[model samples]
Target: MSQNLLIVGAGEFADIAYEYFTVDSPYTVVGFAVEKDYLTEDEKFGLPVVALEDSVTRFDPAKTEAHVAITSTQLNRVRERLIKKTQDCGYTLANFISPRAMVWRTAKLGVNVFIFENNVVQHGVQIGDGCVLWSGNHVGHQSVIGDYCFLSSHVVISGYCKIGARCFLGVNSTLADSVTIGADIFVGMAAVINKSFEDAGLILNGHPAEASRVSAYRYFKLKAPT
Candidate 1:
C-alpha cells in the first residue's frame, strides 16, 4: 500500500482527513489539491496545496494515492464528482476505516469510504463507495448503505435497513429495523424512522419521521435525484 496520500480539497473536511490519516493511519499526508478556482490557500498543515488539475503531474499517482475529502456538498454530488475527477487523474482512491471502529468481519465496504472511530458495523452490512460515516454510528446487521451517502455522527440504522444512494442522514437519527429509504432522501437530525419510504428525493423529519412539505431535491436546489 502507498504510504503517501494526496487529499483532494483544502477545506474543513480535507483538514480533518489530513489529521486522521496522518495520526491514525499508516498513510502520510503528502499534499493537498483542489480545483483551480478554489485554490486560495498556498498550503495546508505545512504541505503544498496544488491545483487538482495539475495533481497527477506534480504528485506521481503510482506512488501517492488520493482521497476525496469533501463533505456532503450538493447532496454528495460534488464529492462524487471530485472522486471521479481524482480517478481520472490516475490516483487510486483510498478508504480509511478507523482502527477504533468495531466492524464485523462479514461487513463489506466499498472504495473511498471514510469511517470514523467508535462505529459499530454489524455482520452482513454492505456500505457502498464514497460513503462517509462519522463517529459513533451503529449500522446494524444486514443493513445496506448506498453510494455517496453521508451518515452523520451517532446515527442508529437498525438491522435489515436499506438506505439508498446520495442520502444525507443527519446526526442522532434512528431508523428502525427494516426501514427502507429511497435515493436522495434527507433524514433530519434526531428524527426517528419506523417504517419504509420508497419515494426518492423526500425530506424525512420529525420524531417518528414524517415527510416534509419541501422536496429534498428542491431544498437542495437539485431539480431531481441525480
Candidate 2:
C-alpha cells in the first residue's frame, strides 16, 4: 500500500514537491497542508489544501505522513513556523531524499528533510529536521546544519561549519571553514562568508564585486600563468 502524503506550504515548493512525490517517491501525495492565513487557494496540483492543524484529525497522520516544502529565501521564518506548528498538531514529519542525490553513509539527517537532486552531503554532516537542501548543494564534512534551514542551489558549505536553526543560505553562497551562522539569518546570493555571524537578520550583498584581474588576463588571451 502506498503511504498518503501531504505537503506543507502551497507556494512554489509545493508544486515542486508535488511533482517529486508523484514521479519520484513511492508515496502517494493526496493533499497539501498550510496555515489558515496562508491558505488562499482551495487546491494545489489537484489536491486538497488542508490547514495544518486540521490535517491530523481530518486526514489522519496515523495513516498519512507529511512534509514541509518551505524555502529559506526569506529569513527562514515561514519554514520554522510551519515545522513547529505541524508537529504541535500531532503529526510526524517526513523526509524526502532524492535518489539521484549523493549522501555519504555516515551522514545523519533529521525528519521532514527534502534533499533534492545532485546534493552532495559529505561524511559526518548532521542535518537537522525540517531542512530543505535544494539542488546542487555541496555540504562539506563534519558540518552541522540546524533545524528548519533552507539551502538553495549551488551552495558550498565548507568543512566543520555550524549552521544554526532556521537559517537561509541563498543560491551559490560559499561559507568558509568553521564559520558559525546564527539562527534566523539570511545569506544573500553568491555571498562569501569568511567569518562567523551572530546577527539574526538579513545579510544583503553589501559591496560591488571586484573583477578578477587574472581572469581578465585569461579572457583577453594574455600570457596568464596557470
Candidate 3:
C-alpha cells in the first residue's frame, strides 16, 4: 500500500521532494503545509497547501505522514524547529530513500531522511533524523551524520567521520577520514575539509577548508535573497 505524505514547505526543496516522492518512492504526496504567515498560494504542485498550524487537523496524522522540506536556513534553526513541531503534532515522519541509492542494509537511519539517487551509504553508517543527502554523495563506512543536516550533491564524507547536527555541507565538499564537524557549520561548495572543525557557527571555504569570520547568514546571504 502506498502511504500518504504531507510535505511541510512550499519552496524549492518542497517541490523537489514532491517530485522524488511521487516518481521514485511508494509515498503519495497529498498536500503541502507551511506557516500561515509564509503561505503565498493556496495550492502547489496541483495539491492543497495548508497552514502548518492546522495541518494535523486537516490531514489527520493517523492517516498520513509528513516530511519537512526546508533547507538549512537560519543555520538550520528553522528546519529544526519545524521538525520538532511536526513530531509534537503526533505525525510520524516519512523517510524517502531513493530506489536508485545504494544504502547498506546495516546502516541505521532515523526518521524523515531524504536520500537521493546515486548516493552510497556504506556499512555502519548512522544517519540522524531529518537529514537530506543530495544526489551522488558518498558516505563512507562508520560515518555518523547528525540530525537535520543538509548535504548537497556530490559531497563525500569519509570513513568514521562525525558530522554535527544542523550542518550544511555544500555541493562537492569533501570531508577527510575521521573528521569531526561541529554543529551549525557551513562548508562552502567545492571546499575540502582535511581536518576536524571544533568551532560551531563558522563558515568554511576553499581547497583546504579554513574557517571564515563571517557567520552562515552573512556567508550564504540569507538576510536578503539573491
Maximum-TM-score candidate: 1
Clashing residue pairs in candidate 1 are none
Q: lDDT by residue for model 2 over 30-73, one digit each (tens)?
A: 89988877678778767788778677767887888888888764
lDDT at 61 for candidate 1? 96
lDDT of 1 by residue, 56-147 (tens): 88899989999999999988999989999999999999999999999999999998999999999999999999999999999999999999
Q: Model 3 residue 57 lDDT? A: 82
Q: What ordering of candidates by lDDT runs from best to worst?
A: 1, 3, 2
Which is better, 1 or 3, measured by TM-score? 1
Question: Cα-based RMSD of the predictions, in order?
Answer: 1.4, 10.1, 3.4
Candidate 1 vs candidate 2: the TM-score winner is: 1
Error at 89, model 1, angstroms: 1.0
Mind giving the per-residue lDDT tens digits that candidate 3 earns over 1-226? 9999999999999999999999998899999999989988998878999999989889999999999998777767788889999998889999999999999999999998999999999999999998989899999999999998999899999999999888889889999999998777888899999888864646456878888777655665655323
lDDT of 3: 0.89
Per-model CA lDDT versus the true structure: 0.91, 0.80, 0.89
lDDT, candidate 2, at 65: 81
Q: On a 0 to 1 TM-score scale, where does candidate 3 land against the true structure? A: 0.92
Clashing pairs in 3: none
- Candidate 1 residues lying further than 4 Å off, grouped into runs, are none
TM-score of 2: 0.84
